[model samples]
Target chain A: MSRQRSMEKILASEFVSIGELVRLSGCRYSTLKFYTEEGMLPFKQEQENLTRRFPREETLVKIKEIQDLKKQGHSIPEIKERLAKKM
Target chain B: MKELSFAQNFSVIALNAQDSLHLTTAKKVFLRCMAAATILELYLDNGFKTEGDFLILNQEDLNSPEISRYHKAVLKTLFSKKETLSEQLPQYLKKVTKLSKKMLKEVEHAFAVALTEANALEEIPALLGCDLEYVTAGISMKEYRSNSELFSRLTESLRAETLETGPMTDEAILMLWLLRESGCIHDFFSREELKRVAERIFELQGSSSLAKQVFPITIHKTIEMGIKNFLKSKKDVMSTASGSGINFVFPVIERSQSVFIDTEKVFANKEERLRDIKARLESKGHIFTVIREGEVPLIKIDNVLYEAVPSAKLYRIPVHGVRLRKYPLSL
Candidate 1:
């Protein structure tokens, strides 16, 4: 299938790109990327181009957890450690 | 002549010069900007701070005489929530917008009262058949005409490539920021001038120690980011929000027709198509006089006035005066 068709298939499965995730979550692109890079959120990367696609449900839940932890005065490293323990 | 708070200045500008400023922004977007401006005003007063992307109230300053009871109440509401007020800037902005919706009438009243006290408010006649108070209906307008000099200065500053020399006033910068957030900046500057104006606005914003102290980025950039996200979600709503109404500013013709233009057309461009329309009409022994020409051109045929959009095949019709939408006008 073409890239467009593949993207549509992923979208049908509720897998979202970073841009779509930003729209869904109302978070800034930079903030989301930070979360992704910190391993606070999980994603699958396409080997062809390394394009990251996130499972929308899992990503949103993880984002909520991170936000709640941040509000409670946890730093990024602490939150990462906490999530690692949970995993 | 007197200084106004950021929200107050926004109200004065938005309400006073809606048409002259071409404020065709959706009411929701306007309300969001008002909310953001109000929040920024409090931020400047050191009433709130950011914890990560979330907003946290400075509890000690809740009782400060500088903060209004309405503002204090909003702060208290956020403070009482055990959880953070929002997950991020855009969500935070959306929360405050609820206050704007609730207090819009109060805001209008307060600003109107201020303008009246300043001897700056003049009540224009209400539209015919609209039996409503100026506050409720927006039928009657109260233009605050005394701030002409201030208006000129703000417009001139936007047009200039650099921030005006010396310390730019906080109120001035805040008003400019609010204008940009409300999306009225486009009406004030052409597409070419907008890029330069946007840069100058950032430079002006950067010069403000107060804003730098309050926000990680300057308040303008923070609000701009939030507004971008907000607008992205609101694109569909905004495109349809312009109401159909006859504007008193333009000559209205009783009769009109809607025409659809071919997307792929023999006309090279909009201007060429408009020229062709004029030629065709004139050749039919009808007098086609161009009144004002731009993206939407106002033309007079024989004796009737009509506004025509070049992209739309609408050759002539009595203008309903609604803003020409981005989509082609089809009937």
Candidate 2:
């Protein structure tokens, strides 16, 4: 296996599973994945398993902040940029 | 069982009474109205407008051996001999009807239906004199008059009781019951139940669909109470965006139809009242075009036309003891 791929598997092992992320974030699965795909939320993929994981602390805080911004009627792209600035 | 519109069924019973039953015109109309109310109660109890609903009004369907005999038995009670010395419907019906022993259980079921409808009517004070007594007694409802005068009193009492109990009002309870009166839906977990349903109507509706946002309750809340009191916890009077001030309408009886709109509670602004009335009427599937005749605005509900009563927001229909006059049925 490539060294970079090996590192990703180890990194993914440290991150929270999708189920745990959903519980902590209070957001739905598709929603969380969408945010992650848009690069708005931090997540990792285990190289061989193809399983996704959320970097627990940062992802939860980011999602909660995103939800607050959403309630304030911020659009998705706007939320992504705003969170990027905060990070 | 054959499918007959509510209007047709009402007309059939009225004609039956007027011609063969030896009922006076007034008595005939009343008999028709009471029969309509009983059928509507059946329709509502089964989830209004659902298939297999007990809406077939033909005598043949009422007595059809294939259908549940209990429903037939109830229909017989509605159409049977007029005079009875006994106030008790079951005893009186038992003596007169010549059904076989095999159908006795179904007859018992029909009696159960009468009991349930009577109990429901009693709970709502306003629904009192829709003439259930005469109809249940196998007599004529037209002998009595419609009881619309008690509107203000019934509304006041309902409101007082409602405000006293928040998030669980009488009207709200009735609203859910109104929405799902059919005993078909016994367990109440609105969202989850919808998910389990094959068609999934709950999700299909828009997010703000009042039906969805309002009716959800914990399973315990439902299981703790009887079906009558199931959605009492989801309290909110369902009102239209305009026209009527609140969501209370009284029944105006007809042969096979009962129409209700609180003309008395017309919205303060005439324009708003017009808007509200049109919106409410249209939402309930009535077809009418608002127009000015001789500079006076009017709403035509089928053949019986209505112009606003001068000074009040209510329609200018003659009411007898709060019941809409029989001649031109608003229904």
Candidate 3:
């Protein structure tokens, strides 16, 4: 599977770094950090490493869902509650 | 965050609580100030020289990357015919009107971009409608409140009693003048305080670095006179059109599509009506050509020619509760 697959396919199989998430979502790095801290987005990190990795497709969808809730005039806490219930 | 220019800052201050542009008398004045301030910025940079009554462009300064697109558009307008005298300010405005509006739109977009970069405003393309051409975003309530506070600070800074200090900064003077000319001064000052505010503005004008440049003041006055004359002429024509000779004050709706202008408001005089229609169409994103075939102004929209007139039939739009007349250019 590794030998036949393209680099993009291999990369998409695993989690994406913060920068990749920023590029994919068109969101600022700080906003991603905020979402992570608020528990609206989930991330994984390796032992003894500082880098944060987000599940690419799920994070992108969650960002859109949060923004849609915001457009509907939801507060941050309310958005968190809604996302919690949805999850 | 990138620091905004005085003109850009003026736009932020003029925005209403919802972050949308407030289409008021202040908007007209703001447009004029944006033009004046951009020209003055170029003048300060030695890109334009005042020769007697005309402002002659220095073509060498036109290519600098530091010069903003708004400034460059103003420079390009001045470059045509090599110079723009005080008397020609109205025509100069007409040529640069579209670019000036784009500049206004750019301010909001630029501010939104800056906010997103700082992570203050959220930039979700799907929800916020961010696209290739426009980068719209959602402003947090916190940011909105901060903006309101900033506007209050600006208002407080210009209080008549606060002018005990002798000389004001150049930006302050320009902002003061913009506020006063826009009739927004009434919003911030009482009748008694207005007299003092006017005095302070006059004093500031005489002392500011802009006054030393000369042509900016000339440009402001010429534009002011041009507006006065245009309004006076419109009033005379409108009164004449009424047949009762009573001057009916027409409400100027900000959105052109929802405009409820009376058919009688359309002047019988072709030239006058042509000017009014031309302005109305241009505001709705239609471009006009300089060449007028015969008496009618030729309006070109996306390579098609169409005459715009308000239809006679009035129907009720329950949403706005105002009578809607279909403007044919939109059809």
Candidate 4:
């Protein structure tokens, strides 16, 4: 399927790209990358391009969780540690 | 015998004149008179022949107090020269006429001062009127009714829809410019006033729910207007504020409302009526956020999530989510 079709498919079916995830969450690319590296996110890793794609529902929930943590005054490291504990 | 008597009278007169003359005396007196006449002529030509003429002259005029004193000294010197010039009346008269011309020239300076003052007085009223007109025009934006007539033609040229999308009305831009020009933006708006105006405008627009979205714009405008007015009043505060490196903090949350809420109400009930919520919050561990120094009641609360309804009733729901969202609290 074309990229547009793939995006539609993700919107219609399951997952979205890292870039689209950043735009939707209003979070920075580096922050998303950090979350991904820290295992704060659940995503499918492409072995060929090393690209990450996240399930839309799970990504949104994680983003909300991050926001909640921020509101609770948890620093990024602390939030990452909590997420690690949860994992 | 009668002819002899006439000749004797003439001889007496001549003798008296000769006694008064000290060689150059006549010439000096004549020159002084000529100088006076020349000055008078200049004054007349300038239409400043009367006492008003003296007022017209600048500091340089011979009639001015300073110049007059100098002229008096020169007159005394001329009188002393009289004795030396008396032997030749014509020569003395010539010198006097030349001195009068120079004196008149100096006296004419008063006319210039008078004219300048007159011009300034005449222009001041008109200038003041123009300034008031500019300010009035600036205050009335094109969106405002009073400005309709002024901006009607421009609106017609562009069409209403295009004009709205194009750029801000010139009046709005000019208002900003005038505020900037007046230099009042900082001091005129006390932190309280900025917050007040911002809140008022937001309330008026029913945008209280979008506090975050509305604050920056409202505060910016409030600051602009405040600074403009402050500059108009103090005229020097702008420079002081700029030099002192002052930065104003306009919190996104309205501080004015915080004063009335109880100290224990901020976090008490996340979703409940105001009074009940306050009671519940106090029961819990919620604490008021102190905003102002020494003001026990000045506290910050999440107004968006929670709001006051009827008497002793606070609702902990977004305004849109509430059953009735009429604002400004009509009693």
The ten-residue window of minimal lDDT in model 2 chain B covers: B120-129
Two-chain complex of model 2, DockQ on C-alpha atoms against the true structure: 0.01
> Which segments of model 1 are wrong by more than 4 Å?
A1-87, B18-28, B49-55, B58-61, B69-91, B98-100, B119-122, B127-146, B157-174, B199-331
Give candidate 1's error at residue B274 in angstroms: 36
Alpha-carbon local distance difference test for all models: 0.50, 0.37, 0.47, 0.34
| Model 4 alpha-carbon miss at residue B279, Å | 36
Scored against the true structure, residue B120 in model 3 reaches a CA lDDT of 38
Q: What C-alpha lDDT does candidate 2 achieve relative to the native structure?
A: 0.37
Model 4, C-alpha of A70: deviation from truth (Å) = 1.4
Comparing 2 and 3 by TM-score, which wins? 3
Residue B173, model 3, lDDT: 60
The positional error of residue A66 in candidate 3, measured at the CA in angstroms, is: 40
Model 3: which residue pairs collide? none
Arranged by TM-score, best first: 1, 3, 2, 4
What tens digits encode model 4's per-residue C-alpha lDDT throughout B1-331? 1111111111111112111112223222322332333332232234232352121323224354433332343333345433222222223223333344344333222222222232311111111111112224542211001122212222222122111112222222222222222232232344654464344434433522222222232112244445434433432321233321221122112222111222223343424434443453343334333233221122233221222322222337312111111122211
Q: Score candidate 3 by DockQ.
A: 0.01
Q: What is the alpha-carbon interface RMSD for each candidate?
A: 21.2, 26.4, 24.3, 27.7
Candidate 3's TM-score on the B chain: 0.45
The TM-score obtained by model 2 is 0.24
In the order shown, the candidates' DockQ scores are 0.01, 0.01, 0.01, 0.01
Q: Where is model 3 more than 4 Å wrong at Cα?
A: A1-87, B15-28, B45-56, B81-146, B160-162, B204-331
